[model samples]
Target: MKERGQQVDQNSESFTFLGKGTDFKGVVSFGGTIRIDGRVEGEIHTTGTLIVGEHAMIQGIVSVGVLMNSGKIHGTITAVEKIQILKPGVLVGDIRTPVIAIEEGSRFHGMCDMGAHLGSGERALSLDMAPGLVATAQ
Candidate 1:
């Protein structure tokens, strides 16, 4: 079991770090994992993981497989897998994820939509019938 854990850790993708005091603005799309400890303003989309270190600040739309935030984010977040907000973290935006874990002392001031079918391959259809009338079309 221990060897399996070690192997998993070794197989994990390396993280690209955005160190403290760095500021970036624009779109970021990548695979694997990324850790940010600075400030970012734009959109971030990835199919891996994102770790927002303490003292980090991000503002924009974020879509990822997994999100671990320990700082602040002000925008919309759509995580396919899960989202974890550590203690002292702050999120001022809406969240859409199937699983969410928020530690104590974290601040999330926005709406959260937790649906099991969120990332499922499903489509929503609109009805074009009258309000009080039923329509049957074959």
Candidate 2:
């Protein structure tokens, strides 16, 4: 029996969510998806997925399998799989990934390292952005 308004195919992976008004500092590591809508001022490492909400702010090193962001981030980020920054997201720092997608209205300014991932047979993120988007990489 499914509850009303429930998602038809909700993800089974339980994730940790840091909602608004929450502020965390130090290292946060998890194996499942995590959604942040607050502020984090330290390292965040995960082996699954990380979602940064529009109101979120993060600063420091981030290592994850996948990342979807619509907030603001400043630091060194390493995503083993891919990274997607949606509209209004702003990322300012160095990123090491093989595949990265920045949509229109997003912003990114940093250096990208993708060669290491290609030769290691590992997936990665990129430094590409669509038109009307602000992106600068080295």
Could you say which candidate leads in lDDT? 2
- Global lDDT of each candidate: 0.84, 0.85
After superposition, which runs of candidate 2 have C-alpha atoms over 4 Å from their true positions? 1-11, 120-138
Model 2 per-residue lDDT at 75:
98
Model 2: per-residue lDDT, tens digit, 14-129? 67878877888889877788888889999999988999999999999999999999999999999999989999999999998878999999999999886646678655443343
Weakest ten-residue segment in model 1 by summed lDDT: 1-10
Candidate 1 positional error at 30, Å = 0.7
Tens digits of per-residue lDDT, candidate 1, 1-138, equal: 010001123266755777787888889887788888888899999999999998999999999999999999999999999999998899999999988999999989999988756348865334653433344443
Report the lDDT of model 2 for residue 85: 91
Q: Give the range of the ten consecutive residues with the poorest summed lDDT in model 2.
A: 1-10
Model 2's C-alpha root-mean-square deviation from the true structure amounts to 9.3
